[model samples]
Target: MTLWNRLLLGLILLSSCWLGLAVTPSPVATKPNVIIIMADDLDSRQLSCYGGKNLKTTHIDALANEGLKFNHIYASEAMCVPTRASLFTGLYPVRHGSFQNHKPVYDTLKSVGHYLADLGYRVGLTGKDHSTKPKTVFPFEIVTGFEPNCVAPTDDYQLNDVRKFITRTNQPYCLFVMSINPHTPWTVGDTTEFDADKLILPANWIDTPVTRRQFVKYLAEVRRLDEQVGEITRLLKETGQDKNTIVVFLGEQGAQFPGAKWNLWDVGQKSSMVVKWPGTVKARTETDALVQYEDITPTLVDIAGGKPIAGLDGKSFLPVLLGKSSTARPYAYGIHNNIPEGNPYPIRSIRDTRYKLILNLTPDEEYYNRFMMNAKQKDRNSVWFSWIDQAPNDPNAKRITDRVVKRPAIEFYDTQKDPWELTNLATDPTHQNRIRQYRQKLETWMKQQGDAGAALDIVYAKKKE
Candidate 1:
């Protein structure tokens, strides 16, 4: 063997080693980045992936198709401020002190921004900024991309800021892209795309001309929301963060229709969450395991490699993400207060996988929502009136409206059999044991959380927004 031939072979081996090192994924590139996109006043049932008969939600459906579909995720409280606060603090509504709309969280609590940032991640938020208040607590790097107001006349937006924020550095990030769509006035989307006549009304709603017209407007905003999801996911792919990032899509709460929002029915309480993590979560999978918004932060912390924050009511569901087990919690609880929205109508609820029990504190007094049932001439377009106007002759309409206004102190439902919660099984003798058990669990949870029962339903001095 010649000395030159041996030297040439050694040089070739060294160059090949350097080439392999260059192509290996960097540590920063492999670190998980989280992007959570949330929708406003959405009816999970309105999405085609969740079995909606309305217009197809192409982008959102794709997320469900490619990620884990959470069949039983819920917002601890159905309102905006409370739900987001619960999500940030990993605490229930009462504990977070944002139990009502426009209410603020306890000024002392730490948020996901603090938790993740301490662990060396940039945490930022864009659009629909509600719970990011008292900047000292939330501390999320404020970025502008989507609209902040839910009631704005227009939703024109630019993604330049969002694009810059996510791709700005190699450091891992947690960015929340909040979208205010299908919320109120329902004026932001292309209403022309939907035919009011052909839309399929939810079984719980009365089939009326006005109801159909109002629903078409709602679905249009839902379409706009779909576009927002599509764009955000596309941005991730464009930046080459598609494979390593953990992407989540959340439906904030139910629509604003009567008996939908500000009530304890499944539509208002139940939300949709679809998550995708390349190489971690299995694609085209689902879990009936119960999860709530309160559990989200702890899971994020777990993803950040941190221990559970002591004293938090929520526990991480990282195992569920890894497909380690099917169950996260045995019961998911609920609460509602109708003070700022209307009169003092307080409610509490508890449910497992199959059954739900609701306790209406003041069942005798009629339930009212200032936004939906107001007598002002301007509110004439609300679908609540359509249900009322047709209630006289339409037996179906009469049953539904009466059910909405008059509530029994105790209500129970087999949600698996009745998805919309149309039948109240409270009086059914067969389910007495389930009702008793759930009520006991409900009382125990309330006591632990310092929930003041109906006393929490009074008006508070308005805080600075």
Candidate 2:
């Protein structure tokens, strides 16, 4: 047969298959490569695209420019393990049995690894494995080299390991490039880049030498993280995988500063999420849709052309990603179980775009985190001590410091009016009805999840490997 005739026959066959004259499947690839680059101890509000004026995150801003940014995404639990556990499995910490810090996910539970693997994806994770163990629930090929702290200089050599994985893999890949940036012992990034005297501190932060010094280091780490992200994106482009990959950059939980990481307030629970899926997701778009870490697994499952597992706590936010839906959930929930790292102070919270309700289960016990509480340690910064010393003269500092150490049983804040949550509205007569509704909703959810609240905190023991 002639070459032209053979080409014409192939076209005819393809058209016939599409028209149902034949039974051949479509030739186009349906599975997409997925990459989630998560930055540890990073805050969404500190990003340039998120109204952050102090630091210029050029690379992260570039991702936001090329993808969709989610404004109200949250971590199910504020700390690393719980939030990461929830992210891996489409279940809250209570249901997954990994709510406590440094605890493993229940042996019988299934995670994203099992779900995506079923659809023929080669899943791998690199840098910071804070999620639960037993390795059965979350099985991943570990990529090497970007495994150190997040403040380390962004080196092109570190990405060589990830580059090999993306270029060598033919089957769909789900790569998690988790960076431990801006975490405590923040001494790896460029300190000279940020001027401690000129940086803008958080409204709730006490203005002291120690506070400024630590924050300056934290911001520098964040900048380093941004450069690392740029390198990954560039790798995808060079490898010709950018078009077929869905790249998601997430600010896992929030920074480790007071009222952020270990608490259940907005700063602690909220995370910054930006997703780029060339043709599938719209670029340069923003949404205020409420999404939680729990929703991530189901969303990935759905996007990977697989059935979402039944009985999962999270539903897929695919519609929101596609710009077909303006909202994902009516409310986002948060939980904080302080044990193994601090005093046993359990907290549960719920928010619906505006108001936030926080229930401190062990309000009578003064809040304490041994690591943060110790300011005189050689490696530790003295922000905590400075705050305590300046409390008498600075009213705002005193108020913030007191709130961090002490708590009431019921706390409510109008997040729309006070984004920082400086004022408690639980006692306001006008907000009584809304407060009651949220409180009841949270209690009902706790009951459904079989969460014993304060009892869970009391019984939490460090898991044995």
Candidate 3:
């Protein structure tokens, strides 16, 4: 062979190597993945990790032990769809036009899917899909499994679709796993594990044989939910994605009890939120920072190395997560506009760490919701009837029944001292000054959110340009 021929062959090999290097993808292109697991109708206090005495939640407690557990996080609305919408869009229900349950947000609104997708992440949803309508607004790649009732009496909840989505994708992803557990018809899980006679009831709960029976069944479902959480986290760890992924578990809303589900009180709005980010967030930490469902989207966006978007009701709680900020917000607001589902009993509330003031806009009318009223009236267990039956005989039982149905114009409570919110301090002369200050705060907030007050009852219409 000639020397010139050998030189030419060598040059060809060097050029091929150069071309391969030029075409290779950069390591920076692989961003961190995010996984959000949301549970339905479970409150923070229902979990043993959050000081729950009634039941033990071993799996969720492990996550809390390994991540940051937030003490004062809340849902923007007490119902499902509205709170879910707020979490995705980083806007309050009224601002997002989904203040009512089963209502859709305005057509133009974009969600976390859009924001994360912009940064080259594949966004997908599994389990419950109760977000706003037009479908395009959320735009998540749908994954299936865990669609049955909370108390369906079957352990058929599968995560195959979600697992396949993760394994198939080489790119980073944002996966939302919604678990429809502890919602209603409480029939799933081992009811026998929780002895009705031995179960400890909440301070506000009326102690009756039927009430105890139903409460134990509800506790059983909560235990089942904790098992599901364990399964999801175990999968992430086994797949070697747990380290790079930020796993968030949220108690979507309060339990479906009489005073908790549809109201704007602490039990209704407070949620259990735990976040695990291997490197960025310090483990085994707890924060008392005030955060709402509206803040979730922005915080996730910031965690994914994205810039903050403008005109959002929620400010990112990234600082709180990173141990840089101790306080997230001074106050968290709540609104409940009951229509279509029940009577037009509009309520607005504002709460700081210690104080809370609730304004019942339609105080002249009785508060009514068909589902809740039916639960009391049509309950086969006669739990609610027992409360009403003993109302006249027992003053405490009477107070509980009256508080469930009746409403005054204004109600105030120092939640620090009155967590159950039994006593109304709005009429107390000693709290008159405090009441006036909170009233002004509530009104200012209403105006800022463009709330139409009682006018919300007369069918909400979009304002003209």
TM-score of each: 0.94, 0.92, 0.90
Q: Tell me the lDDT of model 1 at 203.
A: 85
In terms of TM-score, which candidate is strongest?
A: 1
TM-score of 1: 0.94
Worst 10 residues of 3 by lDDT: 148-157
Model 1 lDDT tens row, 236-301: 999998988899999988989888888889889999999999888998999999999999999999
Off by over 4 Å in 1: 1-29, 378-380, 463-465
Could you tell me how far off, in angstroms, the CA of residue 199 lies in candidate 1 after the best superposition? 1.2
Q: Which pairs clash in model 1? A: none
| Arranged by lDDT, best first | 1, 2, 3
lDDT of each: 0.90, 0.86, 0.84
Name the lDDT value of residue 345 in candidate 1.
92
Better of 2 and 3 by TM-score: 2
Name the candidate, 1 or 3, with the larger TM-score value. 1
| lDDT tens per residue, model 2, 270-336 | 8899999999788899999999999999999999888869999999999999989999999998888
Q: In candidate 3, which residue pairs get closer than 3 Å at backbone N, Cα or C atoms, i.e. clash?
A: none
Which lDDT value does model 3 have at 292?
Answer: 92
